[model samples]
Target: MHLSLVTSVLLTFAVFWNQIEYQQLIGSWQLTHFEGMEKIVNSSQYQNASAAEKAGMDARINYRLENTVYQFEEGDLLKFTDLENQTVVQKEAKIEIKEGNMLLIHEERGDRLAKIVEFSDDKMVLQPISKNSVSGKLIFERIKK
Candidate 1:
């Protein structure tokens, strides 16, 4: 009986803790910078690539850094928007925070998960949780509270 009661208490505490962390994410954030792109760009593969291929890669990365906005709304709703073109990249997406640090975005295409490397009042850093992710840590700044 004592062990069961202790487990229940811990579970409740964990859920409560996660809720607090999720609350902080309820706002509009813009992607300002990212790491690891340089590593990929400097790699031998990128160096050997054709000029057109290199330009494509650079364009994609620039688009994301300058135009991506992730709005985390109430009820776990996430809206990914492209500010440059004023279009919604993904609508009706759901987000969940696990273990108070792992962020999972459930989209129609696939789930994108990231680890919260650092978070503050206006700045957040996310490290993509993927074996194939080479973008490294993404830095976001809160645009709307």
Candidate 2:
């Protein structure tokens, strides 16, 4: 009886751990700079810009992670709509899960861009990478409802 009880406890713990890990990625997040407490906000120019202009603006604004709407879809994919124009940016690429984090890689023309996602209790950071260098960083916070 004691052996059965111990096995049940261990199994329960394992299940709980898995559940928590999954939940960690199942909410809203914001991107902010690593140096300061400033929350990255989208600018107005993106809203009125053309597609080409919007593409250029991509490197300037931060991003928000919407994990609740799209979960477990491939490529560790999360929805990130541009805050200024409300356009979906990373919808085409496949997202991947690495270690305990999420990654999104997309190709535009010949340039390859990557987004490294990191999350905490209240915020998430989306750092954009190009040519193996960080182009910009976006910090997002959970939207309370």
Candidate 3:
């Protein structure tokens, strides 16, 4: 009887711990991607562009995932801010958690930006819905407080 009670307690603790770990990811994250010099040089646009133009374009593409504070008035929005351009774009929609993935819908500029998020440990991969181009995946690591 004592062995069974101990086992039950351990199981309960394990479940509770998992819930806490999942909740820790409910915060903001900064996103970045570094392309190799070879890839950049081989691209037609980059090949024709001057050094300063290439650098400026690369800077503008970096962004941040700002999920720290959500607003109900903005239709349950999640914001992604462009660090280089200092632009804050709000994604107006609802976020739903299903199974182990997060689903979000944002309708703006006549285009819907749907995303699926999968997280483990301190890392998350966000894949956005795309039509012609291949799906773009943004990998993010949780920022420490």
TM-score of each predicted structure versus truth: 0.67, 0.40, 0.53
Off by over 4 Å in 3: 1-24, 34-42, 63-77, 82-86, 90-92, 99-102, 106-118
Whole-structure CA lDDT of model 2: 0.48
For each candidate, what is the lDDT? 0.81, 0.48, 0.52
Candidate 2's TM-score reads 0.40
What is the descending TM-score order? 1, 3, 2
Candidate 2 local lDDT, 64-91, one digit each (tens): 3332123223334455434335555434
lDDT of 1 by residue, 1-145 (tens): 9999999999999767544367888888999887867776999988999999999888877876777788888899988865436443546688988875889989787998988878888998998888785557989999964
| TM-score winner between candidates 1 and 2 | 1
Residues 17-97 of candidate 3: C-alpha lDDT, one tens digit per residue = 543232444666655432333455578988789889888756554333342223222334445543334756444544443
Candidate 2 lDDT score at position 103: 52
Using TM-score as the measure, the top candidate is 1
TM-score of 3: 0.53
Off by over 4 Å in 1: 1-20, 44-60, 82-88, 133-135
Q: In model 2, what lDDT does residue 46 have? A: 57
RMSD of 2: 10.8
